[model samples]
Target: MRTTDFDYFLPEECIAQRPAKPRDSSRLLVFNRDDDHVEHRIFHQLPDYLNANDVLVLNETRVIPARLKAQKIPGGGRAEVLLLHRLGDMTWEVMVGGGGLKPGKKLQIINGPQAQIREDLGGPRRVIVFSEAITPMLDRLGEMPLPPYIHTPLEENSEYQTTFARHPGSAAAPTAGLHFTPNTIAAIEDKGVRIAKITLHVGLDTFVPVREDDPNKHPIHSEWCHVPLDVVQAIKTAKEAGGKVVAAGTTTVRALETAAHTSSHQNIPEFEGPTSLYILPGFDFRVVDAMLTNFHLPRSTLLMMVSAFASKEQILQLYKMATIEGYRFYSFGDAMLIL
Candidate 1:
């Protein structure tokens, strides 16, 4: 329950600097919970391990170009902004970084395409006033806010999002879904494994560390999610047929599990709304039977959630193995499928 319990040593070199040449070429560390076994294989080999009755639930939320750096007018001081979420009617919850642009300061952002600080709650989260709707401005001025660890420049912003990215709301990609290539998804369908999509607009909260030692004491951030009726029916049908429900990412897992809470059946409930469920050890997984996820940062809630899916010791052991074997880590890194 202590935050330190999830800690592990990871060499700096193991943090992936960039994506693999062919996206699906990255390694897959498959963990079978039923037998407590691990298999190392390429990601493209995913279809070979799945079958017709299985259901693959994926998060289809798209990553927007959220980072925008603009110079303050008149004096030309610089300010960095990462748009968190649009609060509609021309308001936005923006994480802006700069000095002097305090509360009530009316500043021109980037040469007449202006904005004003209506409020500054401090520490990166702010409420801003954009002269016009944010959509047009973001379409022109924003850049994808890649994870801080990936220092290289992204010539194409699309690479930061998955190939199947559709809804443009998530600040971050549901990374486990990142490993799947177009061919890989096609192959999965070819094997008769039904693929379903859900939406969980990932936020900075998913990456925030557990500040409390006891997992139950930590607060979680709410994220907007939607689980469609079809995906629900498919999961229900699959379970009835004695097939497993495999979640593609933690985002999808959270969405599906949240929905299942309302179901008359034990594991698959129908749901739609915002969820702040912080999954950790001792949490009963009512819906998901298997999970596909990316390597997470040390002591992160994500790592702890995965630990809950398997045992904390098993998850930590795999992390050590991943580090020693030089498997890439974090958003653009390798993936693991816990079956």
Candidate 2:
């Protein structure tokens, strides 16, 4: 399909600059696929729609403080680096924003160690080798890589992270999970809905829009993900009990579907690796029966994914309705539940 088909008009005021005060207080738009009905409610009321037999899968991948300020060693020009993936203890694949960041160029981190460009991976991507392991110093040297649309700075680093975040790797937070707080999760668990955790380290590519005329020609980047045996067992139990598999975000959908995609048998196996599964329209969904996600940008892969889960026309109409209803959009925005 044409990438232009996914494009829509979004007013600048609709973009959320800050998260909801209590996290769970954010608005939620629920769409029932069976009845073609819709309901607008608070995110804290999510448990009302969940059944006791359902399994809610959440992505526990934490967002890293990936953005770093630096200066050229010899010329002293300012630069910025965004860590995308860790290659080793002292090496990372990053996106550099500066001139002359080519191989062999040295840069001094603002308050961290020295780094050298090892290789250029075309465009803004480069392999950087640091003087020492930068992971430990990231807290002091790096800043959260918030989306460019979020003009207001976060009051705290944890503002961008989900309350259940554990394993640190993702460059961006799973916005759908961001709506959950301890109380919200407690209420869901108290309803007897099983909670399962998976991980898919989000990359910046998730926010990148498809530039190609045909979306099929877009190069989707692979993200590291894991679908553990426990999660597989949880899904099996939920399905056997006639329960739905409710994915927290598109990342969770990708991870679970990737596990199913790679399996040779009817059941999904434990998977741990990078997944490049693109959920275009007409894709056969084997795992997820419901989804909770944020309003994505127009022409974005995230939007395309939800379109695949539902239909492009329906999703577009819902988005337009949400806009008219004054629902916030993008990261740190309100959420939508599709079932």
- Residue pairs with backbone atoms closer than 3 Å in model 2 (clashes): none
Model 2 local distance difference test score: 0.96
**Model 1: worst 10 consecutive residues (lDDT sum):** 104-113
Error of 2 at 259 (Å): 0.4
* True-structure RMSD, every candidate: 1.5, 0.7
The residue ranges of model 1 lying beyond 4 angstroms of the native Cα positions read 263-267
Off by over 4 Å in 2: none
* lDDT for residue 55 in candidate 1, whole number 0-100: 93
Per-prediction TM-score to the true structure, in the order listed? 0.96, 0.99
